[model samples]
Target: MTPLSPDDYTAIRLSLQVATSATIIALPLGFAAAYLLAFSEIRGKAIIEGIINLPLVLPPVVVGYLLLLLFGRNGWIGKLLNHFGISVIFSLKGAVIASAIVGFPLLVRSIRIGMESIDKQYIHASRTLGASWWDTLFSITIPLCYRATLAGMTLMFARSLGEFGATIILAGNIPGVTQTIPLAIYQYTSTPGGDQMALSLCIVSIGLSFIVLLLSEAANRKMARN
Candidate 1:
């Protein structure tokens, strides 16, 4: 194995940061969406579901381009953010947004499944016992679905850590700023005599993914036991 360079370390760190930020920002939103889908007979539910899952089915490049259109400097929201001195494109923050979009569907799916598995009778009981809607959700629904939420977060983190197409398009791959592991690996592979570095990064990515899967399985088992 080649000795990892400072750049490689930076890349790994940035990847983790991006993944963590993405997962954190997306978690509450995912849970809310899952809950809505699971419990509500709201109008346009199918349309909302399709929109939530669109990122998973659409090409990553397409998603990235859409983000650029919606969040780029020249875009509507982007211009507003810029007026407030917040920039999204070509920055680490942009990477986080890109990663979140890419991982959103998986997070939503996992949480939705968990919510669906919850017994509606429990909710009814909680309400009959005079629990408020928010209280019931926090005390019962959230605790019961915690394991699945964690699993969803783990999967989203893993997916975000290895994201390339969206990150590259939205964040511009600036080293130490937005260059994540996958982008770094791609860069290494393109340089002369950089195969070892690329291999090392590839191994790191695989290791991260493996750990996420193991943790998810463990969480599932624990939930099952309880």
Candidate 2:
């Protein structure tokens, strides 16, 4: 448990890659989604929000199956991608996609809460100063909501790191490719005499999650004081 094996290290590395990739992919879209849900006056706002948040309530396995339907080689988007010699199914890219989908709701919700809590006075002032929507977004909205965005990203990162059901279904547990920490732990637990290995991975997972939470809190405190 103290020392990790090469395969375990690989799993950790893959997890980091998947989580980071997922966060990066979701960042801009998540912010846009949060902004829309918080400020938009569209008639279908609730419907859009529910669709965005479906992954949170739906089973992860179900989400994965849906993704497969959309991105499998024979599937619509997957066929287009395959025509270009790109592959997603059962690949690292698939793992990132799965993690991103599973963690998207958390990212959107956190930013939405932060944006909604912000005083509208600053926005009005920015508008009065002749700042355009894009300008205000960069100069006012984003700056004031930086802490929230960071917190959301951190939470989403943690979620992505722990993603299992969707990832296993879409990405598979192929070592050196899509075998993330959770998949590795599952594999170890299922094997005979592999309890010790599974336990070690579990501890590592707990430690990493705790560290991410602490870092998120520290960032919030720092931003609050600044």
Candidate 3:
């Protein structure tokens, strides 16, 4: 096997970092949205669902553009962040944000399905036992659907790892910095005699995706057994 160069290693590490960060940041929000859609009677639930899924259907470039408009140096939130000496545009942080936005729908959808599959009897029993709303959610609902939550997280991480268009548009492809595996692969393919590196990255991405699939299957099997 050909050893990867330092630049290639950096790209791999950065890709992992970006995807992990994206997954961590989005997980809670995804869970909350999923729970709300599954169990609540919130007003405008359909509108909330549409807004959550918007990034899935929108062009990646448009997502990036919207991110830039909302988080650019001079944009409202960006300007506020800048005052604190933080910036996301053209940075690894921006890549994380972009990936989270794109992967969010998948996370929410998986969790929603999980939540829907849960037996309502358990919740009702918990309520009858005098468990509070939050208590029932944490002790009953969430625990019962843990496998589904894991599946959602795995999918979100895999999706974030492969993110490209939004990453490039929002963060740019700066090697060893904002450049992730997909962005690096794109860069390699654009240069002469760089197919080898691109192919290597592609293989790594495929392996990662396969592992995620395996984990999801394992989770499903575990759920079925219970």
Candidate 4:
């Protein structure tokens, strides 16, 4: 096997960075979406949920293309960001956005399952005791779903790590810039005599994913014990 190059190392680092960033950026939004789906009584919920979970069913390439259109120079968002000197297309920010959008449904699904499992009696009791909605949410709802939230984050992080098509389209596989593990592997596989490098990155990707799962399970167990 060929020794990993500096660019490979950078790809590894960037993969982790992008995964972490996407997970962090998506966490709050995921939680809110879950909370809405689980507890809210708004009309058109089915429509809202369908939109939220659309990426899960759509081809990643399609998602990427849609994102590209939304963030292209002629796109409204792109124009607005350009005025502020912020770029999303073909950049690290674009990579994170792509990952977040792709992985968000998993996060929301996990958290929603957790939230739905919580005993409604407790929530009712909190409300009966004069707790505000926010107070009940913070004091009861979120605590009960902590494990689910962690699981969601774990799933999202792993998904982010493996994201390829959407990321390639939005972030462009620029070495040491937006290139991640999957992107680097894609590059290596296309280049002659680069099988060894691709294999090396695959091993790294597997190891990182394993570590994330282990840590998530450990945290869940610790929370259970507490």
The candidate maximizing lDDT is 4
Which ranges of candidate 4 are over 4 A from the true structure?
Answer: none
- Model 3 ranges off by over 4 Å: 1-3, 219-226
Would you list the rank order by lDDT, best first? 4, 2, 1, 3
Q: Write the per-residue lDDT of candidate 3 for residues 77-190, one digit (tens) a residue.
A: 899999999999999999999999999999999899999999899999999999999999999999887887888899899989999888898899999999888998899899
Candidate 1 lDDT, tens digit per residue, 1-226? Answer: 8888998899989998999999999999999999999999999999999999999999998899999998988999899999999999999999999999999999999999999999999999999999999999999999988888988999899999889988899899899999999999999899999999999989988988888789778878978898
CA lDDT, every prediction?
0.92, 0.94, 0.91, 0.95
Q: List the residue pairs that clash in candidate 3.
A: none
lDDT by residue (57-158, candidate 4, tens digit) is 999999999999889898879989989999899899999999999999999999999999999999999999999999999999999999999999999999
Q: How many backbone clashes does candidate 4 have?
A: 0
**TM-score result, candidate 4:** 0.98
lDDT of 2 at 70: 92
Model 2 agreement with the true structure over 118-213: per-residue lDDT tens digits = 898899899999999899999999998898899899989999999999998889999888999999999989999888999999999999889989
Q: What is the C-alpha local distance difference test score of candidate 3?
A: 0.91
lDDT of 1: 0.92
Candidate 2 lDDT (Cα, 0 to 1): 0.94
